[model samples]
Target: MNEDRLQFWSLYATRFAEGFGFITLVTLLPSYINTLDPTGTTILGMTISAGLIVGFYTSGFTLAQTVAIVPLAWAGDRFDKRTVLLAVLAIGIGVYALFPLVDSSASLIAVRALQGVAVTGAGLMTLSLVGEIAAGSTRANHIGKANAASYAASIIGSISAGSLFELFGFGPIFAVIVCLMFVAWLGVFRYLKPDETRIHGFPFSDLALNRRLLTLSSFRFQYAFSVTLVRTWIPIFAGVAAAEGGLAYGGLAVALTVVAEKFTNMCCQPFTGRLSDSYGRAMFVFAGGAAYGFVALLVPFAPTIGAALALPTEIVLVVPSALAGIVLPAWIPLEVIPTQVSMFGEVSPAFLPLVALSGLLGIADSFREPASMALFADEGTDDGGVASSFGIRELVWRPGSVIAPLLGGWLMYEVSMASVFYVGGLFALTGVGTFLVILVWSHGRRALVEW
Candidate 1:
């Protein structure tokens, strides 16, 4: 392979491992909640609820990422992004290795915070590097491919984590994760060249004030709330008990819910990125954001729609097994089909519609993500601090990613689970509206069509 191909593949491998490790944890979250926080944990003087604990656990990682972004991104720009990425990969290996030691909610949260830092660093550096190497016209397509790599990993991670945890336990699952990260580290050390460009000091203050960035931030800030809530809670809703405002699907079924979105997003992004390159990126962004919000709003009604449509009840198939002479009978409840054929269980009526909605979420994001990323890269390259520019993007996302989960958990525990999706959908709608008005007001009406 040539240098450019080697570079992209190395970065892609790193992204895959990052996604693999991250999604492994997400796939295992329901199990963690069931095992570690059956009664909830008391911090300071107050007794926290189970749902609130889930929020805190999930948010802990993002909080650490929020803290680590500035320093990591700054170091990447000022020194070598390749070095930063390597260090982050090493940290990820350590973090996953420690997952086996977690015995309580507190320990799990602590390890997750460390994992968050590793993830943020790897994500920031990889994205910055990809943007740097890609041609201006093809930047979005490259980013889309990179993101598709991550989503593909998410699909594998989700399915494998559930299956492995079911067959063995957390220890073996994380051991595999550690191995993956180590391999990613070795790949980076072997193939990715050191970044030579160096910017002197902090570039965030100026980048933060850039008019285009500011315009983008107006939408991103709100969109963050939408995505953080919807993405995190979808699996939660699928796996938790129906009594707890969930569908009570098995491990593999829950994995499917998570994978559905990722699968569609992975499949669509490359094509979408090329289209965004040809068309106006801003148009794709606005349309995608609006569509995402609309779909999210419909998420709460999935069960209702499924019931009204009166979908089929069950499916059965006979398939060959690993053993040469063995054949297996697989039965799947139509309402909630297990992704794995070995599991026998009935899920709620809402599963298929929810899965459909998840796919729509993927499609909507596929439209927004690459275009949005390319726009950021365009500005970052212009400013000569690509890492810092991406850092600001991460920073802008932090407030929402950090806070939305806590709020979603509270709503799930205190109110209805559907309410979380409703509110998440609202953020997307309002965010797009905010972006549209600002674009017309500041950049002229034709800017929406021509920018």
Candidate 2:
């Protein structure tokens, strides 16, 4: 490969590894909850609830990412991004290998926090490098491709983690993840060129005050809550038991729910990026966010839709019986029901509609992500702190991401599982509304199309 192609692909590999490792952990969370703490445990002599355990465990990852964003982004800009990225990959190898050794919830959270740092460092550096290398005209297209690689890895990771965990337990799955990270580390060390671009002093002070970034942050801050809640809970809702307001589907079925959004997002990003490049980016961002909220509202109603639509209750297959040419064996239903049915063998009416809604979520995000990313890249390049620009973006997202899971967990445990999606959808709608108001007030309504 040529220098540019090699650079992009190497960065892509880093992005892929980051997504793969992260999603694998997310996919196995329910299993961890079941195995590690079926009921809640006490921490520091205070009784912690099951809901709180889930919240802390999930947020631990985000919290570490939140804390690491500034330092990692600064390093990427001030030093060599390639070197920083390699260091993160090395951290990732150690973190994933530690998963099998997690004996308690506290230990798991500690390890997940380390995993968070690795993910954030790798993500910030790779995105910075990709944005710097690509031309302004096609920046979104390149970013879209990078994001597509992440989403593709998400789909693969979610499915494979669930399958491997079900078959061989967490040890083999994490061992495989460790191998993937090691391979990514080797690829970066061998192929990615040293990044000579450097910025002295703190770049965030200047970039954080930029008008464009402020406007984008207005949307991103709220949008983070929406995406975090919706994306994280979809798998939780599918995998957990019915008494806990979940579908209680098998690992594979739960993975499919997670895959639905990612698969569509992966497929649609490149095209959407090119479109955003040609047309106005802000429009796509607003439209996508609004569409996502609307879809999220519908997610809670999936079971109702399935039941109302009267989809198949039990799938039947024909076999050649000894006495007949073709016969349906009673035993066939027994085999299919356990793996396919939800909630004590009454075929889950919600599966198809939930998957469909998840797919819609993906389609909605596809419209927003690339356009939003390109806008950041544009301001970053113009301001001469591309890494810091992306850093601020990640920084802005941290609050919402860190808090949303805690809120979602509380809502799931206290109210209902469906309440999480309701609040998530509301956040998206409100975010889009706020963004539009800010855009028109500051830039005029014409800015919607012209921006």
Candidate 3:
């Protein structure tokens, strides 16, 4: 195979391994916590608290994604992506190894914050490398494949996580992930050779999350915000639909949603990724945004579960993949800007989305993600509060999302499946507006910055 082809596989392997952090939880986390904490225990509440606290803690993780990306990408640009990436894998594996062994809520939260930091490699370095190594023509297709690997990982992660939980317990489940991270690190180190590149210094200092990255990073927050909001309701919506439709899938709606999206995102992202490379990043961003808008419309109006699964195809494929694939490929190049100095590095890693969804994630970490991201934003970044600001928003979603489960199991559970679809669509539509405003406001400055 050609060098590019070889690197593609290497990138895929690393990404596939990295995906375990989030996807496995789709099927494993809730019950896993229940196992450790049991019912009505503080430990279980800690998981919810962890989700909430992690929103804040996740900001720390964003440092790994951006602050590190700035310096590392600079290295790759100046020297070799191989060395930079290998170092990342080592640090990542070491950090991820700590994830499974935490014995208390505080420890687990610390580990999760650390895991959030470690999770940055696949997203920041590996994905950015695809753009660096591939000719522009083929970059998006490669990204799509990367997304596919993630989807595949999500599907497999869920399956494996659930089985590991059943067979071995959380400790072993974490061990499996640790082993996967090790193997992934080794794959990149041994087989993935980086062809030498000669660029001027990746300008670690220049890429500082200064005005430019910060300003543009502000724009990026819109997409993240919208995504967090709409996604928060997905699990609730899906479960409600399953129950209302009288499908056996009711209980596992989140898992099934995760499986569906993982597969579809894997299948479709490459095409979209490629399209963004050729047509311009805005094309895909707007297209995805439009599709998101369309999908939002579907949740509100979907007549049947099958119809919900069909065209305008956003949620039909949205599962656990990259926060609803809300990404507008044009913006991803920011991953390379010296994360610490660049706006993307300094401000964006966690706060970009957290500012929007910290609360949303805390709440939706249970069911949705996009809804969490979309909760709030001002013309500037700090203008908004975490999802906690929209404290009552859950009250709106609870009726359809949280309550339906309680009620469905209790009285008047027989509500139409379409109602959940409609409710989710409303949250999604709110996201659509957030996306459009961001798209319109940040019109000129879509160019990529290098560290």
The prediction achieving the highest lDDT against the true structure is 1
Candidate 2, after superposition: displacement of residue 162 in Å?
A: 1.2
Cα distance off (Å), candidate 3, residue 66: 6.2
Per-candidate total of colliding backbone pairs: 0, 0, 46
Better of 2 and 3 by lDDT: 2
Ten-residue region with minimum lDDT total, candidate 2: 336-345
> What tens-digit string does per-residue lDDT give for candidate 2 at 1-451?
6989988998898888889998888888888877886467776999878797898888999999999999998998899989999999999999999999998888999999999999999988898888999998888899999999999999999999988888798889888888888988998898888999889989899998898789889999999999999998998898888889998887777888889999999999999999998997999999999999999999989889999998765433443344332354655644333322232233488888898999999999999999998899899888878888999999989998899998998999999999999999999999999999999998887888887
TM-score of 2: 0.93
| Candidate 3 accuracy as lDDT | 0.45
Task: Kindly list the per-residue Cα lDDT of model 1 for residues 32-74, writing each as its tens digit.
Answer: 8877855666779999887777887889999999999999989
Instruction: For candidate 1, list the clashing residue pairs, or say none.
Output: none
Clashes of 3: 46
List of clashing residue pairs for candidate 2 = none
Instruction: Quote the positional error of residue 11 for candidate 1 in Å.
Output: 0.4
Off by over 4 Å in 1: 38-42, 313-315, 318-344
- Return the TM-score for candidate 3, rounded to 2 decimals: 0.58
Which has the higher lDDT value, candidate number 1 or candidate number 2?
A: 1
Q: Give per-residue CA lDDT, model 3, range 86-118, as digits (tens).
A: 776676677656766666545654555556545
Worst 10 residues of 1 by lDDT: 320-329
What ranges in model 2 sit over 4 Å off?
41-47, 314-347
